[model samples]
Target: MSDESSNEAPRTVRLDRELVRALAHPMRNRILGLLRVYGPQTATTLAGRLGVNTGATSYHLRQLAEAGLVIEDDSRGNARDRWWKAAHQGTEFDKAELLDQEPELALGFLHGVGQSYAENIFSFIDAVQTMPADWRDASVLSDYFFHLRADQLDAMMQEVLAVLEKYKTADLTAPLPEGAEQVTVQLQAFPRETR
Candidate 1:
């Protein structure tokens, strides 16, 4: 998630060992993602949405805040119902660097991220049958295998990301037009060892 092309540059945070360690927890990752996707929300609200207890949600939120992944949004909510939001719209890091520096931390963080992506894909699959004709027709769950050098793959990924960024919905907080829906697009590129 990033900023609108017309708006100010997107806020991005670079991941370090400490930050990655903080985000390695599945719950904390989910909390940060919820705040980013849906905007600021109280622990109670997040708990209800995530089906977690308020206490647990609050604890995770506090951890994320301490790690600088999220921040208290003083503009909304009162003392009793404090609101929290994602500090950055997106994150940037070198996976190889992190893996080399802290294998366990990197693996844990990547596992959590991969699990989230799988969950989203499964959710869509579960609802696809009941989805409207228009949406169902528009949905995609396909992958292509490409044989390319590392540099070629990297260049292709950059091009793909640039295209996605161009078409990304500008304001998450803004009301969507009729028939519009929030869509999730996931991209994964890695060299698989041949059997």
Candidate 2:
């Protein structure tokens, strides 16, 4: 099986109306996460890992392919069995566009993403206790209250993205530099409500 990230196409898709609808389900997001991180997998394998039956995994895989989020990896499985992988390294979209264009759909997508993110955060917390002290000390779960104008926040976000983009060309799964570890920086910024 080809599990190398370098071989896959670099794709970043902006979700449209249909794609957003296709991605609205929790199970689909979970499955996508597996494929995105683990590379090609069969329905039977995914079923075992996710604790779902093969039929359900297969069905959701078909739906995700319809939305162009994943694709069949014929090289990884025989005719009797099939394998799937994410078509893109990751997805990108404008949250503001979703809010302005389709509020209802935006709510559903945002809720789903929020749920997935919470699950991941908790999982990281669960594993932190077993990690080396150096890593644990470096990792932080923090929240900051900012009283900034919208433009200021946008500028701050752009600077953060610029820093992240410096490492975009490196293959994350490969051996890192002398002092580098894969770090996931999840950013969420929202304005506070008026009293």
Candidate 3:
């Protein structure tokens, strides 16, 4: 399947603990993030951009490829310079599936992901602050809070998932306005209070 088309709803695949462990590395996570954002890239290019040695990058790339997180772009030549892209546009892991067997590990992984995003947001804010006035004026950086009384957790989850699906399927190839650049949009939702 084409990488662009692979962005649709992902299949329900069993996520093994080994796969999660492979993804727990900071460099691998960053590599995945880069593949998702930049389409496809060669290990040499990734190594240069990430300031890591090509050998190390290639090793991690192989690990990710073995775990099915990334796939070689065979359409291009299978030469040493071949590029690799993410196998799936997104990934899903059932928390309940892991919680029963490895509650602590599952929770720890989730917490690390949350912290990574928090750090990323701060870095983005720092970059924004250093941009020219015109750029800052055209940018959007805001936080919103809402409180809702939900009758059922499942229904609430479905609603939020539906919204996310829309954004995930959005057409992003449209031409932007003059001088406009891509901006990161992060959406996070969780139970604020447990009753």
Q: At residue 29, what lDDT does model 2 achieve? A: 79
Worst 10 residues of 3 by lDDT: 167-176
> Candidate 1, residues 103-171: lDDT per residue as tens digits?
999999999999989988999999999999999999899989989999999999999999999988756
* Predicted candidate 2 versus true structure: per-residue lDDT over 1-195, tens digit per residue: 344656766656788777778888888878887887667899999999889999999999999998889999978788788989888777777878878888888788889889988987998899999989998999989999988999999999999899988867444434667876767778888898979
Off by over 4 Å in 2: 1-10, 169-182
Which candidate number would show the highest lDDT if scored against the true structure?
1
TM-score for candidate 2: 0.86
Output the number of the TM-score-best candidate.
1
Tell me the lDDT of model 2 at 179: 75
lDDT of 3 at 124: 73
Clashes of each: 0, 0, 0
lDDT of each: 0.89, 0.83, 0.73
